[model samples]
Target chain A: MTCKEAFQEISKYLDGELSEELKRALHEHVGRCAHCKVVFDTTVKTIELYCDGKLFPMPENIRNRLHDLLRRKFHERAV
Target chain B: MHYTSMMALEVNRLEKGTDRLTGKSMSAQPQKATERAESELIAEAKAGNGDAFEELVNRYERRIYRLALRLVGNTQDAEDVLQETFLKAFEHLPDFREDSRFYTWIVRIAVNEGLMKLRKRKSDRSEPIEDAVDDQGQVMPREFRDWKPNPEQLLSQEEMERVLLDAAHKLPASLRTVFMLRDVEELSTGETAEALGLTPGAVKARLFRARFQLREELSKVFKSEKSLDL
Candidate 1:
């Protein structure tokens, strides 16, 4: 892919929005362009690293309060 | 400006997974949570069953809270947004259509609430706000380099997690929200666009900038470690 074409379609490529023909062209470009290849590879890995993150536990205090508030609302709505 | 810009060209064609319906993404190595059994609870809750609804809150509270924290950049504000978001969702339940998954629907609500909080906080500031990044027609071209010694080779997973979290918090509200939704939460570009009320192209553009900035942060961490090894 021309560097110009790469920048324009990189987001679409990541988002899986590219057509088969375009994907082939981009892949061809990256296969030859060392810089784009590294940038593309690392970008994929970086997103994977973050996506690997676990959801942190909510504080017990807030969880309890949310329960209380929601129960209260549910009851208030029921009545 | 002679800024050194780094581009992350991750073309994970064969490796990545996407939820066909919602476009939710999962890591290549780990399977994400399976489709939640929310239909039963949603039905009961919609009919005014308090206990049933409480169970629903317990299920998604943490996910919503994390999304809020990333968007608003603080615990207190995130908690506030979380509380308001659920209340808003519950109040509007009678109007709910089962077109989308329950988590997707709630997440859309939470995004709205979180962004509202960001806007209010910005207004409360003494200084007039300026664009976080002035938009020029094109992203400036910069020298590209490989992030060698790879993430797995350079740092422990926990170390990577800690530094990435901190760096994520540093992104501006607009960028952070898009990043958290599209990348962190794995929402499809269309879902993200709908939540933020932007076009799909806008979501893609914001996501591009977010990924660019975040890649820069990752480079800094690895570069610093390289020096420490010297």
Candidate 2:
């Protein structure tokens, strides 16, 4: 596969959606090409960085307010 | 019990006529137990049980908030989306058909609320949320330097979050929503498509563009400049 084809398939490759044939071709392309390898590795890292749950913890105050708002709404409806 | 297990239990009960009064089959299946509990909670909430509804709220609030924060790009609007999502869900709980999982149903509501928040903010702007252009021309990797491993170790969590959020905010809302739902929220492509009212093909294409753009944006910060310079 060419670098362009490999690059286009990176997302599908990571998402586990690539067919076996395309996957093998892209894997071979990245394994041999330094540039495609960097792009593929960094893209993997990019997903990891965003997916870390610590990056965006929900604040306790916000949680409290949400529960409080729900309580009030429920109470008013009950009345 | 699982269907097969339940059938076996029923057959055993019929043959042996034992454990008929103990309800032993219900105790053996954890998956069914959880489903039964959820259905009971839904039924109770639909019958005006506030506590049961709160139980459901507690189950999904953090995830909903995170999704809202990612989509709307702020704590305040995220909070508004969270509050509005549950409020609206509660108001319409009785109308909720059981065909969909409650989480998916609530996620749909949260997405709508987030979209409304985005729409209100973008009213003066001309960019449409649905970006239909072919993004392939823009997706080529210009930065070929490998990123340093363990970037979390290099940057504080807050700094990392800022960098990530800024990169995410760079995409048009269309691609951002698909990426956030499919990647960040870990929703299935089908579920994300359904929530956004787009086809699975659209979701896949936009997800590709979003991931490529985000990687490119982040590479600006995390790339190994020393190697590239050499």
Q: What is the C-alpha lDDT of each candidate?
A: 0.68, 0.78
Q: What is the TM-score of chain A alone in each candidate?
A: 0.71, 0.92
Tens digit of per-residue lDDT, candidate 2, span B125-218: 7545656576433567778888876677898877887888788888888888888777666677888888889888888988898888898999
DockQ of 2: 0.35
Lowest lDDT sum, 10 consecutive residues, model 1 chain A, at A48-57
Per-residue lDDT of candidate 2, residues A47-78 (tens digit): 65666665678999999998999899889989
Top candidate (lDDT): 2
Model 1 residue B30 distance off true place after TM-score fit, in angstroms: 16
Q: Give the TM-score of candidate 1.
A: 0.76
In candidate 1, residue A49 scores what lDDT? 62
What does each candidate score in C-alpha RMSD?
Answer: 6.6, 11.3
Top candidate, metric TM-score: 2
TM-score of each: 0.76, 0.84
**Candidate 2 deviant stretches above 4 angstroms:** B1-36, B123-128, B132-138, B228-230
